[model samples]
Target: MEFFAVLIAWGAVQFWGSGAIVQSDDWFVALRRSLRKINGAVPRLLLTLSPLLLVALVLFLLGPILFGLPAFIISVVILLYSLGRGDFHIQLRLYLNSWQRGDLEGARRHGEYFDPELRTGAENALQLHQAVRKGVFYHGFERWFAVVFWFFLAGPVFALAYRLLFLIARHEDSEQRERDMAFQGLYYFEYLPARLLGFAFALIGHFDRCFPVWRQLSVAELPSDDYLDQLGATCLPGVSAEEAQDDSAFLQRASDELQAAQQMLSRSLLCWVGVMALIELF
Candidate 1:
């Protein structure tokens, strides 16, 4: 039943579009903002969130008792909410389109949506392009893979908890200390799942190159972005020497690589679904 719910949520997002599935004006953001206004320590803020989470969990737990076949509804609602409210691919497409048109300003604007630290004047075209790719890869994990991983690991409650922690961690205006603490918490939450996704990327894409990259990395030493970038790069087939040298050809090649990376992500997701199905069967 959980697996079926996962499929339904994934299908809705894929066909109906995430924008339709997740409302723009969600209470989660408001709740985060209200907590930010508390002017307390990070621990205090986290403590404040605890009861809210507890209430949500209680409600979800009661769902099965109160209604018939509640798993599907609860799972779909949580999954839809946990996934990115906006369209990641649309953002990527906007960046790529602006980039191909030689509109650096437009490209940088859209690219910063993925990577807030991106600076328009700081990096060259190739560097900026690579940064966008890395941003997309990591953001995809946060928005999709991480949420799904938690859902299967526990249920809707843990999935919601993971996303709440993510929101608190990634909130823009929070104090540096609070943001750091939240991000650290999120890092721990995602530690194992990121590795799993990286391994999946290896299997679905270029096994030989990606697997070694996956195997060689120590969790203590590597940050998530570096791990994702190195493994994702390995999975992609490189452009020809001529394509690399020419400016227009280079942009085209980069676009293709980005598309290929997206495809790899999709395949890895399907692989997860297959494994979960097998587990259910046995």
Candidate 2:
């Protein structure tokens, strides 16, 4: 039943695209406002999220009474909502088109949509390519892997909670301590899922090359943005600086790398679905 719900949500994502339904930032705004009224970070987070959590809990409880359909529907809706608030593939396509057209400025501008800190000013095309690829992989982990993980681990309610925590960490602009607290909460929640996804990426991609890197990385390194960034790049087909014989070759290789990365991610996603289906069968 959970697997079916995931399949339904995945189909919806394919047919409608994740961007068709716009999830409002208004809730986050309200939560942030409410948090400001609180004294401590943990209290602030809890108070702001408690109501939604309660509502989600109520919905989950209704599932058994309603013959599991309600739970299934709730899972689908929450999974869709939790799969990031934007269209991941669309932005990647736009970035690729811009890069192929020799529009470095456009690529950088689009890249910022994924990561505001992306260093677009680098004259080295490879550097810019690496930065953008890193951003895409990290965001992919956040948007897709984390949501599906929590959904399977618990239920729709926890999935929704995870997404809320992620939004708080991503969108809230606050003092160092507050930001640190929010991010720490997100980091801890994502720790297991991220490693799992990294392992899957290795299995589905260049495993001999990717798995060793996955093994050698320390616990301290595993949870950071750099881990996924590096893992994704290494796991996918290699794109070397030597490939950049000229500007055109450099741009072409970068485009190829991005496409390869996208394909790798898609395969990893399929691997996840397959694993889930096997679990469901057994």
Candidate 3:
């Protein structure tokens, strides 16, 4: 447990490091390629990789004190490994650049670089494009932030394992029905944690609105595809998860008429600030 302090420090460092280095190609390109290989591997291969990773993690964990390496060094090793996850942030950078470039469609296309399925689900080119950007906040907090935050709280191995588990969980194969089963399992894991992430944002941004909104949103029945979460994000000032998830038909009855999207934008930030304050408080 002596290394626990290292774990916490490493978590903070890696989180900040990610924000700093997300634009670099060195980590993202390598990670995407490596993950693609791992993705193509059989499940049994992952089982094999898991134990090996475990061994390596344990060695570094215990080696720091016993073998003369410093704890900070050990922590740096773990964070460096995480920073190898370059592909995860490439689309994000692209999305941001697109916005900077006034290329809304480019931004949208870049955002959904993850799954072809999600990319296809949007009603039209525009909806598909926009959904990707709207989805970024979720990915930013959930997949990147919370996953790392929780993992580093544990250890390098724990963090890597958690992410690997989710990556494996997200894989859909030949069986169409099985995909739903896997998705269900995925959400099950995310249920409480995702809410916790919201709480974290609440802690950071709005100390005033943090806990109460977190509690309220926790019980709120989110929409299909977690649309309720989006609506709740609309609970933030000026932010509109509703517009983010709007229909492509241009004429069809929009499914997310809960409120003005501009308001949703503002409210989402309020919620974010609130979650951040919550994190700071507790």
The worst-scoring run of ten residues by lDDT in candidate 1 lies at: 19-28
lDDT digits (tens) for residues 1-282 of candidate 1: 667767888888888667255644356556666676566666645763584477466656767674635645756777778776578888888988998897878888889977888853436767777888898788878878888888887776777777777676766656777777777877787888789888898898778777777888635456677778778888898566687668888888888888888888778878887888898788
By the TM-score metric, which is better: model 1 or model 3?
Answer: 1
| Between candidates 1 and 3, the lDDT winner | 1
Q: Which candidate is the best by TM-score?
A: 2
Q: Please estimate how well model 1 matches the true structure, expressed as its whole-model Cα lDDT.
A: 0.75
Local accuracy of candidate 3 as per-residue lDDT tens digits, 1-282? 323433453365447544234223354334434555344344433443354365465666667585545644554454444432334445555655664565656655665564345654555544543365345445544444444454435555654444444444454421333344444544654565567556544654455765676676678655223532453343444324564454343212222221233233335434544454465457
In terms of lDDT, the poorest run of 10 residues in model 3 is: 250-259
Model 1: C-alpha RMSD to truth?
A: 2.6
lDDT of each: 0.75, 0.77, 0.46
Candidate 2, superposed: residue stretches over 4 Å from native: 19-22, 119-123, 218-220
Each candidate structure's TM-score, on Cα atoms with residue i matched to residue i, is: 0.88, 0.91, 0.53
lDDT of candidate 2? Answer: 0.77
Candidate 2 shows a clash count of: 0
Query: What local lDDT does model 1 show for residue 121?
Result: 48
Q: For model 3, what is the C-alpha lDDT against the true structure?
A: 0.46
